[model samples]
Target: MCLLLLAGRADAAPIGYSITGGSVDIDVKLDGVVIGTSAGVALTGDSIMMDTAALTLNALRIEIAPTLISLSTHFGGFDEISVESAIIEGDITFANLWSQDTGTPGLFSVGAGPLLVTGSWGATDSTGINAGTSGQPITFPVPTITGIIDASPGLRIDSVTMHSIEGTPFGEAGKHLTIVASYSIETEVSIVPEPGTGLLVAMGLTALAWHRRSGSGAGPAPRG
Candidate 1:
């Protein structure tokens, strides 16, 4: 789905994202603080890095759709927003587009300005449903991911850097691989409610009334 792009907000939730399933190493930081990082894991065909023709950073956006929080914990326990994958598609043109593990070429810098992230969120839980809604993909017995979002900047082309460590699957045992990125970060999270929750509630109330008036609970007093 299309993400959001708005000016900076003073009151926004600290946005967070995650990546899963890939044989790669990556670390993302906002300014100097590390928000998300990965050692050397083996993910399948995940994480896409594309290049953009826009020579300069003309626009920026970050977006995060509020997902379901498991309701089976303690009176609706602290469920986590699991991020399965991440798609970073923007235009980042440094100096060297191709390097062979010779230690980051020369001028290593990013575009100026606040790295605005759309799906990243405008505020934490600020965009979620505060009231109870219908049942999501999360059920009692077995649970499967109900939603998937691609916060992709959608501005692509090419560029990448790989670092192989020892003892990794691609090589020996203790070797691994990794990719790294750095930028000034400001984040926000939103609560994207299930559109069907409202309808579910209405139906439930109607059912309850019908049940109460079904048998003995039906009809009024005998005009007494």
Candidate 2:
């Protein structure tokens, strides 16, 4: 029989974090099985945490940060700027709190994760840099940024990656641009029992114990 075993407490307290930028996509796992996924919301960089104290789960992942992806640009000498790409070049750092020793800060690492980029572009003669009458963007398809990433075992990670997309508009040899965009992250979190369910269970058990003890200690029903 295949016996899956783990050696950590799934009921550990939540780890606090503050996202400086970008939204995140979160999923949770228990014993290698996915329990559920939650959509990420934009944060104002406030210190917060994902609660995991009542869970028996053992796995967490940063599945995909699609919402967190962003774009920045730097352009000069051009009168018009077209953001043909969301991310031209960038860097991101991730941290896995599950792998660190208790009471100490966790270690961080870099991963070459999924990204988004441009698939095509128009040239200087295709026209539309300076003489283009209307300011309608020449649309380009977004391409998938796929690749493998590296990380340590026994860790729950939350990460943010930042990228800068730079480009020079066609025919406008004098315009410049400096753009910055942050990419979304995909991550997995630990799952626990339904919210408030664990607490109710604990309370029920305690009440039951008190009732049993009280009955056992009471004398036989008062003589009628």
User: Which candidate number maximizes TM-score?
Assistant: 2
lDDT digits (tens) for residues 60-127 of candidate 1 = 32222232222122122111222233333333431222312213332122232222111221111223
Worst-scoring 10-residue span by lDDT in model 1:
139-148
Which 10-residue window of candidate 2 scores lowest in summed lDDT? 1-10
For residues 1-224, what per-residue lDDT tens digits would candidate 2 score against the true structure? 01111113324544333334445343322222323333554322322233333211122122222221121221222223232222222112222223222332332332332233222211121223434222223222222222212221122224222222233343335332222222253233323444554565666677778888999988887877
TM-score of each: 0.19, 0.27
lDDT of 2: 0.30
Query: Once superposed on the true structure, which residue ranges of model 1 sit more than 4 Å away at CA?
Result: 1-191, 219-224
* Maximum-lDDT candidate: 2
Per-residue lDDT of 114 in model 1: 23
TM-score of decoy 2: 0.27
